[model samples]
Target: MIHIEHVSKKYKKADNYSLSDLSLFIDEKEIFGLLGPNGAGKTTLISILCSLIKPTSGSFSIKGLTYKEHKNQLKQLIGIVPQEYALYPSLTAFENLKYFGSMYGLKGKSLDEKIHNSLDHLGLVKFAHKKIDTFSGGMKRRVNLIASILHNPKVLFLDEPTVGVDVQSKNVIIEFLQELNKNGTTIIYTSHHLNEAETFCTRVAIIDHGKLIVKGKPKELINNNPGAHNLEDVFISLTGKALRDHA
Candidate 1:
């Protein structure tokens, strides 16, 4: 289980906290989502959990592993799919996966097989030898995902995994995630795709202004809210339509 306790963050120049005493518990094998308007600190929370940054105060642990005590072990336990492409444009898809796998001490036949399998599953087998610089946005996104999961992590943290992909790519990505979840990989991801999250996520937390406003199963949240026909309705009702103008 992932335990977050009284987490908070305040940038040097920022007046308000990016996250205000946020606390959450994510269960094992659950597809947990953090839904929020821009500047809601979704990214900030994920970064803290991934150990990319330190929180101003508070603490968190995953499966009893704290970043402070088990940084290397924790890295092995979790896979991260950052918002930006972490690919080297000059390398071929296969070459890129090879580099990523080696980072975790994965090599030889098993590693090669894993790379091919992921490529085939993600419909990138034909493009395996293609340069990342020549791949489409969706293709690169798919490759980025494979890089994170090649070592088979216990938990996966994805930040906007499907931001600019086409419908076909999105479906493939979501299906792959579902398969990963079924195999006992706990997934915690952030997304703006309300419709996709509605069906894909088992439960979701809505955050805004660096605070959690609501959380529940999508169907339950929608059914309970009067006149809420879908997750988007509930999202808009709770988050409001105003632009989140911030630095």
Candidate 2:
């Protein structure tokens, strides 16, 4: 479970707030989606939640623990998969994973088994010994995902987990996430893939210009918006067609 209250963020010397008094809650075992175009503040919100950055104002707590008073507990309670590939290109997949696992205080046979099982599950077992620089975009994405979840945190925050991947890789990643959700890991992910979120998310929030626009079940949102037949339709109706170009 997650709780946020009037959270806001403004970059140093920036013209505007990246997140402005945004507030929302994500329930346990729920697959929650944050959908927005470029410059929509999705990543900013996630970064604040992950404690990669502190909020300029207001507060949030995950599973009854605030980052201020319970930083260590919060660290152990969540996993983060950023949009960028957070891997050492020179390291083998297995080696990279082992390093990550150790950060969570895992060791020995247990960590090894976890790494191998995750690699196998994500279709990368054969490439376990292969260097990350040799892997394709999709393979790297899968490896990035495996690295985040090896510690099996109660909540997983993923920023564009499927971006730049082929359809096959996307499917594998989505299915893998669905399985994780089914087994009770709360998932909060940001994505531009409306169709995927339409079916994959239990609830979704569409935000723009650092604020919440709408939030609800995908079907409920679609049905409530007249003439909207799908999530994309509702999204366009709300967010509009202008390009969200930014520096």
Candidate 3:
């Protein structure tokens, strides 16, 4: 569970806030999607929640624990899979995962089993001993996911988890996440893929220019918006058809 109260973030010397009074609550075991255009503060909000950066104003708490008071506890409670690959190009998949597992205080047979099982589950068992530099984009993405969830985090924050992968990889990743959710892991995701969010998320919130524009179930949002046939239609209707290109 998560609670946010009037959370706002403004970087020093910046002309405007990246997040403005953004208050949101994510329930336990819920798959929540944070949808937004380029530079729409989705990443900023997630970074704040992950404690990668402090909010300029207001605050948030995860599972009744604030980062200010429970940084260590929260670290144990959450996992993050960033848009970029977090693997070491020079390290073998198994070695890289072992290193990550150790960061969470895991070791020996238990950690080894966890790593092998995850690699097998993600279709990377054969590549476990291969250097990350030798992996394809999809393989690297799967490895990235394995690294984050090695500790079996209660909440998982994923930014564009399936952005560049082929359809097979994307399907596997989504199915893996769905299984995690079924077993009670809360997921907070951000993506430009509205179709995936429509079926994957229990609830979604669309924001733009650092403000919440709409929040609801995908079906509810589509039905409420007259003439909308799908989540993409509803998204375009609210966020518009303009390109969100940013440097």
lDDT (tens digit, per residue) of candidate 3 on 1-247: 9998998999898898989998888999999999999999999999999999999899899999999999999989999999999988999999999999999999999999999999999999999999999999999999999999999999999999999999999999999999999999999999999899999999999999898899989999999999999999999999998999976
> Candidate 3 has what TM-score?
0.99
Q: Total clashes, candidate 1?
A: 0
* Better candidate number, 1 or 2, judged by TM-score: 2
Assess the local accuracy of residue 90 in candidate 1 as a C-alpha lDDT between 0 and 100. 100
Taking the tens digit of each residue's C-alpha lDDT, what string does model 2 give over 204-227? 999999999999999999999999
Candidate 3 lDDT? 0.95
Model 1 is weakest, by summed lDDT over 10 consecutive residues, at 238-247
| Prediction 1 global C-alpha lDDT | 0.96
lDDT of 1 by residue, 91-119 (tens): 99999999999999999999999999999
- Alpha-carbon local distance difference test for all models: 0.96, 0.95, 0.95
- In order, how many clashes per candidate? 0, 0, 0
**Against the hidden true structure, what lDDT does model 2 obtain?**
0.95
Candidate 1: where is the Cα deviation over 4 Å? none
The local lDDT score (0 to 100) that residue 206 gets in candidate 1 is: 96
Clash pairs detected, candidate 1: none
* Candidate 2: clashing pairs of residues: none
Please identify model 3 stretches exceeding 4 Å from their true place: none
